[model samples]
Target: DAGVTQSPTHLIKTRGQQVTLRCSPKSGHDTVSWYQQALGQGPQFIFQYYEEEERQRGNFPDRFSGHQFPNYSSELNVNALLLGDSALYLCASSLALELRGYTFGSGTRLTVV
Candidate 1:
């Protein structure tokens, strides 16, 4: 009955560095999605994973990639970070293919210096 969980609560990085944020989906769920929420903005979908494969992707660049494990846990990897990348990175979970009724974790706030 545990909900989605994310790591590091907060992070600070410099431009051109890389960062990895993690997530564990809720029980009985098979899909994990990553979203980027700028301050005072709704989350914009980054990508989705199901059946151990990426099923859908957003308009982000190649710098944004993710993986979903067999246990339905996931990770979001951002490479060559930019000052623009400094934002709250959120991880969301859903059952099967249901994308709307998502459960979100408290995100990892990344600040690029």
Candidate 2:
């Protein structure tokens, strides 16, 4: 089965610019979660999507939003990005309603210039 995958293994953007990162969940999975990993810090939960609806969200600003598709893939969008937004954007996938450990993709590294 195919595992999670993320695009633009690395990204570079200017401050105030908007960016969208994409993710494809593992085969047979129905839930996707996004995380932000800052240098020297653990991955912080950004949000989670299940059943095509957001199930949980963290303390991020309105600029952070996401979408899940019928295929179980998802996308994360950040508007008016800030320099602080520079970090590794990780995508994890799991079976429906399963609190088990997640399988993470390499992630899209966002570098706000």
Candidate 3:
């Protein structure tokens, strides 16, 4: 019954550093998607995972990656972080790829100094 949950609700990093953010999908959800939301902007899809494989990806570079476990939990990793990468990383879960059924987490706010 719990909603999607993301760890390290807030983080501060420096350029060139790498960061890994985690998320646990809601009960009965099998798909996990990651999004990046900059200040005053809408969420930008990063990628989506289902059945432990990446099913779809956004316009982000290869440095942005993700994984979905058997338990439906997921992780988002950004390598060689840039100051422009600072934003709210959101995790959304759903029974499938249906956007209407997605449930989002509060998101992990990343600040690159």
Candidate 4:
């Protein structure tokens, strides 16, 4: 089965706008995690979703939101985009939140103008 998959490999948005990023988990994964990677920096966790609920979150602002479906796919929604929000957003999937089995996608590169 395929690993995690993300949509719109790249996109550009204007400030104050909102964007929604999509993710599809691996065949057997039941959890999805999202992260943001700025230039020259490692990915910073945004949040994780399991059983359609937010299981955990990082230090990101409330402007960052997400939802997991019954089929294990997920979406990350960012509102009121700012220049600082321009970054690579990653999607990782794991079985039951196991870190060791995380399979990540290439990520969606979002550039806020």
Give a tens-digit lDDT track for model 1, residues 79-102.
Answer: 999999988988889987576789
Candidate 4 backbone clash number: 0
Question: Which has the better TM-score: candidate 3, or candidate 4?
Answer: 4
Output the lDDT of residue 83, model 2: 96
lDDT, residue 4, candidate 2: 95
RMSD of 4: 0.9
lDDT of 2 by residue, 13-94 (tens): 9999999999999988889999999999999999999999999999899899999999999999999999999999999999
| Per-residue error (Å), model 1, residue 21 | 0.4
Candidate 3 scores a C-alpha RMSD against the true structure in Å of 1.1
**Candidate 4 Cα lDDT to native:** 0.95
Full-model lDDT for every candidate:
0.90, 0.94, 0.94, 0.95
- When 1 and 2 are scored with TM-score, the better candidate is 2
TM-score of each: 0.95, 0.97, 0.96, 0.97
Compared with the true structure, the alpha-carbon lDDT of candidate 3 equals 0.94
Q: RMSDs, each prediction?
A: 1.0, 0.8, 1.1, 0.9
Among all windows of 10 consecutive residues in model 4, the one with the lowest summed lDDT is 94-103
Clashing pairs in 1: none
